[model samples]
Target chain A: MWAFDTIFVMEGMKMGEFKFISTLASVKASEVILDALFVIAIGVIVVFIALILLTAIFWLFGKFMQQGQKTSVFEEKGVNNDTSSEPHILPEIPVAEAGISEEVVAVISAAVAAMSADGKRYTVRRVRRVVNRPVWAAAGIAESTRPF
Target chain B: MNSLLQAIVDIWNESGFVRLFTLGTGNNLWERIASGGIGNLIMLGIACILLYLAIKKQFEPLLLLPIAFGMLLVNLPLGEVMKSQFNTLVPLTEQEYANYLKGIFDQSYPVFEMNGQYYWQHFETGGLLWYLYQGVKFGIYPPLIFLGIGAMTDFGPLIANPKSFLLGAAAQLGIFATFFGAAALGLTGISDLTFSSQEAASIAIIGGADGPTAIWLTSKLAPHLLGPIAVAAYSYMALVPIIQPPIMRALTTKKERSVVMQQLRPVSKTEKIMFPIFVTLIVVLLLPSAAPLVGMLMLGNLFRESGVVERISKTAQNELMNIITIFIGVTVGATANAATFLQPKTILIIILGLIAFSVGTAGGVLFGKLMYFFTGGKVNPLIGSAGVSAVPMAARVSQKVGQQENPANFLLMHAMGPNVAGVIGSAVAAGVLLTLFQ
Candidate 1:
């Protein structure tokens, strides 16, 4: 049998004798230390490399995010929709009258007027008030915690 | 009247209480305690200490309580809760090994046959704890536990700042360092206590600070050491408050600790949904061994983020997670029978596990300093210590220490970036080890 000075191979391996090794025998002291060092060196490198790959992928994904922002801008400008030739026509949204105080409406109108002073046209068509707690909040769940 | 009195006295002499306490058959309390051995007593004492920590101190009580109770149960005399059905530990003769295999695998339902002769057996069905432990032995509970963790994790912080992945990768220093420490102990000349390569691998994983990963890796690499490794991993996790702060303070300068980070840009919902799928593909393709853990974790995250399966996601996080945690705790606890637990190797594992965690924390903080210098002090080095993979606990410690330095600084969100990254990092480290060893 092939052997080293401190090696004491347990009974499991055999020539043409398929036996599984149940317990791993200890190696020489030097060998153990060296093997451990080798594992640490290689393992650390592997971890960094794997993470680096992930970072690169995410960076690439950031480029796609910029593109998505541009796409949303186009949609806002009616460039990617059926109303591209008719910005004044205004896409209609169905609405129902909602409970709101005149003071609240006046405040919203003032806020919109302040923004429109820079020649940006804007409109406020409807307002609504929430009277009851959401179902999740009533059931003792928080919105921030729901996803987790 | 005399005949009736005599019959009653005979029945009293044969009662279970008399059998239990009588000295004649060696079933008395004194004899039972003596036969239980010094190891059994020691383990029982350890179990009691663990229980006090778990119940009174609330030290990861969900897992520690079950494990300590399991330890207490198995160490008691005459409790067959952890006894094996067969003498599998002793060396079996060639014929005996064949017979043992035949008994378990053949069509004979708890019996073995040889040359038209039959013998009754219970190889597949042992103690109740043994039956429950199959979930651990076959590597079932850890992945299921990961599913729950997945459902519970919010990857938004990690997705918001993907560079936190590097800090997560850095904290795995504990696993590799402890591996070296365990092997180095072989030179100490304690033959019975020396760790083999496999044992060292298992012990080293205690530093990963991820309980499920530690258990899963132990079940495969060093099946016998699963109890101590799992216990060490979870105990250190609960002790995060005690262990991580000192290391974090030591590694970073006052200026580095006080560096306030800029707010991370908001991540889109599409990015959150794509994060898990892309991670699953990249990790599994690169390291197939990580599939079991990383795959399940991603699947759970997908269930949560997909929004279509809220019920299933909630069930995974609550009911399924709770059930598996109980099984994993009790079964892993039962593995620490007095005979196996009260050994020199177990003590070494405990000590080395602490060192591993400490070193891991330092590694992450030091790496954070490097990132701080590179980024022109934009990143706080204190949050780097959260890279040790103890989840929100490590992250919270970062926040606590940061707030102490600068009352206005809030590092919770910033620390969470690396905190969640550490989870993926440890899982990846585990994959690397499993791939290497397997």
Candidate 2:
């Protein structure tokens, strides 16, 4: 942020008092060129260092996350292999009579049958409305007063 | 009855209306205009032109409109709307200079010595706009604007491809280039067009192409030039569509422009949350001078990403940003009082600012080309021009130019990487300069 406190001190001096005052003030083409080149070199180096540091840090983080995921996957596989020794039991899930149109259900059932390769008869279960937030609300726009 | 009538007439004679008509008084309408002279008329015309550009042309109307009105309001005769205070511009008299030097070493003396003698004539209490200008004059508004920008900005693209940071840094070429250019102008023998190092540095930052950063730096380095610098920065930003395309085309071949970049990996929510914090830590530690801008920006981003402060994030993005923007625009405009803005140096600043922006664009594209060559055509050079820190605008220009080469080439997301990086880079540049000067 720009602060006003420094305004008084800076204004009291001319040209903000450059460290290489004499060379810049004289406006000698060669000297000015040298100073500018020096500044560019230093500025570029500084920016590159800061940005490159960030890049390296993020790269390392990505690697660490990947490694952690790999370890978790291995642990999950180990648990499943050990559990395979026992008989697996499937729990029955309760079904509800959902209010779906007969014709729509028939169409959906037929499509699912057509795509099935093993030819297992399936029953059309239920239909429900998907209650989801609108895009504006999800994006934190309180109401639907958005122009677009 | 006659005595009462005489008393009434005496009261009328002493009123403001009577004072306005009195030819020789300071409040006289004619004398007020006369005091401002031809410079005031030119500045008024300039303000009108700015208004036309803002209202009709729609060039950054959110900012330009307020700025133009401020310019118009401050330049009018007898407005008493602005006063020349000791900003970075006004040259100190010999006595004032001595006192100023003494004040630096002598803690007992006030920072400003002979303040009355060095200052321009105006009302003792200052004018209405001057009061409003405190936000800008004291350097309070820009950081708040940065907070809003932070809440609004998404760093996902920059985080997805950290390499864009180099492009962002490269885009600051114009700033340093323009600094040299402004100093070079001093040797041209036009006394009115010459720039002090401070003025040149402030003017050079116009190339950074970020409005708040430009205004912030100007307020610190050359507060007097804030009006022109802000106008030039915002105007060029608005003109990005016009200014950037040709430069992008000229810099890259058709094949280079048509090159399709690899899809960026999906950024996880955890990464998004950590990005702002990591950046704030890295940047502030590297350059503490950037703490206010970079820190506030990161804080705002944290607010948005944390998902815990939805209300504050929304306010920061919308209400707070809008309010500060209005104050910044109008108050900054008011600083362009006729006497200061009508000089030849103002013209030089405008010209140099454009040059700075152009050079910055070129620098980014050139760096992109270098990266492309190294990466074996993996990076599209077109996205490099987005490094000038105009945010979505520069990125859009890159996409537009790339599409012209290949109709199916959608470079927006890829371009955004450098685009957002440009913002960080420019702020860093400002921090660097501030550190150097301050």
Candidate 3:
């Protein structure tokens, strides 16, 4: 901006009549224009420095974007199964025509009721449970009958 | 009096309906209707190309057909039908020009005091495109139209592969590149041209290959260029399959195109459900200007992924997307009125836009090739070019070109990774441009 206004000043134009710059700011003389240019340069340099820093941050984030996510399928599966201790049931409603017996239902319900020690009838609900226990322990535990 | 009535009758007499049934035998309706002025002749030629692409080529027919038809109508010069100025009436000489021929001035539109004659001191008026331009100018309809866009987008793929955000950033190379080029080109003493640096940057961002992002950016930077930039962006997006394949083929050797990539891992619904919320919060808080686009887009994705919002999501994807697509397309097409669109600069705009797309494609693919070299052949080189947000279109072009090279290679799934990434990359670019330029 100062360089431009100086060229005009060299040509004998009045200080206030600097018409070439964007209609954003008025210039009083070459020195004022220099001051404005200095401020603008500092502002721009600060912005560029900020952007370069942001880029480095984003790059660091990108480095971790896919880290630690590359374990083999088989090994992960073995560890996952070993850490859970419940026979997961599908969320679908039990079909009566599929030979689900009333005795079995009653026994399971009473076992759960006895364990809970509550007054309400026991019912199966869909819940994602991840319990840590030995596989045999999960398989052997009977849902005992309980009541409040 | 009969002559006056005859004139009205004469207007319809030449109507093909009259001659068709009565005179029959010889060719009638189709022949006369085909007679076109020079403006229409050009429009028809362009329309024919679009028709061929839509019907025979099966390229984006839904949008191309209507847009082509609208262009045909606008250029036909059928008197004052698609009127440029709404107040353009043959100014009624109210009380007989008996007051000594007042004064005359070329004072364009609605001026109550023109030359000193107050014709409008007794009358009222409006600008034609002004009413229409409002929907384009005030950033109203496009964002509202975005509600539909937000409803339609599937964020699952993007969320499943968040690293693709890099590809999105890569795709915006054309926007910044074109902006610098346009700044150099500058108006440079073109009087009627009134482009702010931001305005020029807005128009240049259309190169990013994403329409909504282009619109979002344009609305912020240069509202005047909205109509042209939008029409161009969507038109080119529709043309992606045709426009990109040849370039892809030209750039890569047959063996390079055939490089196979490993299949993507199974994406879980749990991951998908969490994706939109995380992306929205991070991107919006970080770059508020990008919220209108990234926010709405993520919202749409959340609706689709949350599973519980299935009903609302379904309506957004289907009804909202479809309705807004039509409104946005037509309103944009209508903006190509003759006066604004007919200038020499428009051709330059088209030329520069194509360059922008090509550069963006090349930049992404080149970056991909670099990664491929570094990874020692794990990454397929063809997927990089699909890093354009034209969505499935750019990806499909990459797939087609890859198939041509090896005939056995299936690069579609791999290409999708970059294709979705390109969308995010362009948004990030938009955010950067907004932060700096605003």
The numbered model that scores best in DockQ is 1
Give candidate 2's iRMS in Å, 1 decimal. Answer: 6.2
Model 1 lDDT, full chain set: 0.79
TM-score winner between candidates 1 and 3: 1
Docking class of 2: incorrect
lDDT value, residue B146 of candidate 2: 86
Cα shift from native, residue B294, model 2 (Å):
0.5
Q: Specify the poorest-scoring 10-residue window by lDDT in model 2 chain A.
A: A1-10
Least accurate 10 contiguous residues by lDDT in model 3 chain B: B17-26
Clashes of 2: 0
Superposed Cα deviation of residue B81, candidate 2 (Å): 2.1
Share of true Cα-Cα contacts across chains kept by each model: 0.46, 0.34, 0.00
The regions of model 3 sitting more than 4 angstroms off are: A1-148, B4-58, B72-135, B140-157, B187-196, B253-255, B435-438
TM-score of each: 0.78, 0.77, 0.62
Q: What tens digits encode model 2's per-residue C-alpha lDDT throughout B287-371? A: 8888888889889999999988888999999999999988899989998876567556777888999999999999999999999
Residue pairs with colliding backbones in model 2 are none
The per-model DockQ list reads 0.27, 0.22, 0.04
iRMSD, model 1, in Å = 5.6
For residue B295, model 2's alpha carbon misses the true position, in angstroms, by 0.8
- Alpha-carbon shift of residue B374 in model 3 (angstroms): 2.4
